[model samples]
Target: MTNIEKKVIDVTGLSSDQIAMLEEIVAALKAVSQTNNYQGKVSLDRLEETPQPSLTLEQRRAFLQLTLEERRRLLAQQAENMVEHYQENTEWQEFLAGGIIEY
Candidate 1:
């Protein structure tokens, strides 16, 4: 069998929670992946339209001001989920590599 097929066959035993976490990671990865090849300026107008929780002005501003480093650290937490998912379902390795999920 091909390497990816072999990997998928190997990952059939994942727990439900593990699968869910992998899905979440995949979503986050997709969101950040655009940065890898960005060539145009990003606008904040869309962000301004999105409704957030009932934070005070200061709290909202603070959250908006988070540094890229801080965002990366937060995003890295998704890796923990990815690892757990992989351990539970070895076949997920293929999913990760295929962009079906995140690595």
Candidate 2:
């Protein structure tokens, strides 16, 4: 028999339906992988283009002197900034309005 026929005979145990189902699964996995790869590439490009902040040693020291409440407030503000940076819907607005974030 031909090489193609030989290969097909080797897996003759799998019905035609099984082969088709396997192909469908493989195609779906490939599509998902391609999408994930594209997203990862875009994320990497964005990260590379984003500027890194530089802080002086004195500024870092002063930041460390903040009280726990002050630190929480600063962190919440930073979270808000990140949300705005990504243009994400604000889910923390209610929490902020509730005054759960101490200043």
Candidate 3:
């Protein structure tokens, strides 16, 4: 078999959806390499219009009243959910926490 097929065979544990995403990335990279100027848009479509765990005024007040550790746990949970759904990492935890704390 060819090297590309062999490399693909070596990959493990990715779902079909993940593989599809990687293939799309590879195609985009190839396009950029060939043309030297990719016109592709970087989409924020993955970031929904509404934030997750949307809070009402009362809910926001209650969340603001939570102790720092409690707030951290909630942010961690949200980060975990994001990781599960979007392959996003926990690095976003601090950023989210900052937004909530500053509000």
Candidate 4:
């Protein structure tokens, strides 16, 4: 795999809540991925065995940094039953939590 360069995230424009939410999502995903109940494509054992190409902090933050309108779209797309679906869809949940709706 190709290596990705790391850079600092310019979070100056983000509100405290947004930053907190972004961090919260990443931590939640990682934590859930470690759980025995996790039913995602990638297992905890596999994760531990693999040298994954992790995203830079800036890249993760940038991926999650969405405009207000974008947030609205995500909400609309996932406002109801989607959360239930996300519980089983690890990748989509992570993407949604990162301000991306993979549809």
**Better-scoring candidate (lDDT), 1 or 2:** 2
lDDT of 2 at 21: 50
TM-score winner among the candidates?
2
If the candidates were sorted by their TM-score against the true structure, best first, what order would they fall in? 2, 3, 4, 1
Candidate 4, run of 10 with poorest lDDT: 1-10
**Candidate 2 least-lDDT 10 residues:** 1-10
Clashing pairs in 3: none
Query: Candidate 3, residue 19: CA error in Å?
Result: 46
Model 4 spans > 4 angstroms off: 1-9, 36-103
Inter-residue clash pairs, candidate 2: none
Q: Which ten residues in a row have the lowest lDDT in candidate 3?
A: 1-10
Per lDDT, the best of the predicted structures is 4
Candidate 3 global TM-score: 0.34
Q: After superposition, how far is residue 32 of candidate 4 from its true place, in Å?
A: 1.5
Q: What are the RMSD figures for all models against the true structure?
A: 18.8, 24.8, 17.9, 14.3
For every model shown, what is its TM-score relative to the native structure?
0.27, 0.36, 0.34, 0.29
> Model 4 over residues 39-58: C-alpha lDDT tens digits?
32354555532333455676
Candidate 3 per-residue lDDT, tens place, 54-75, comes to 3345445555554477567656
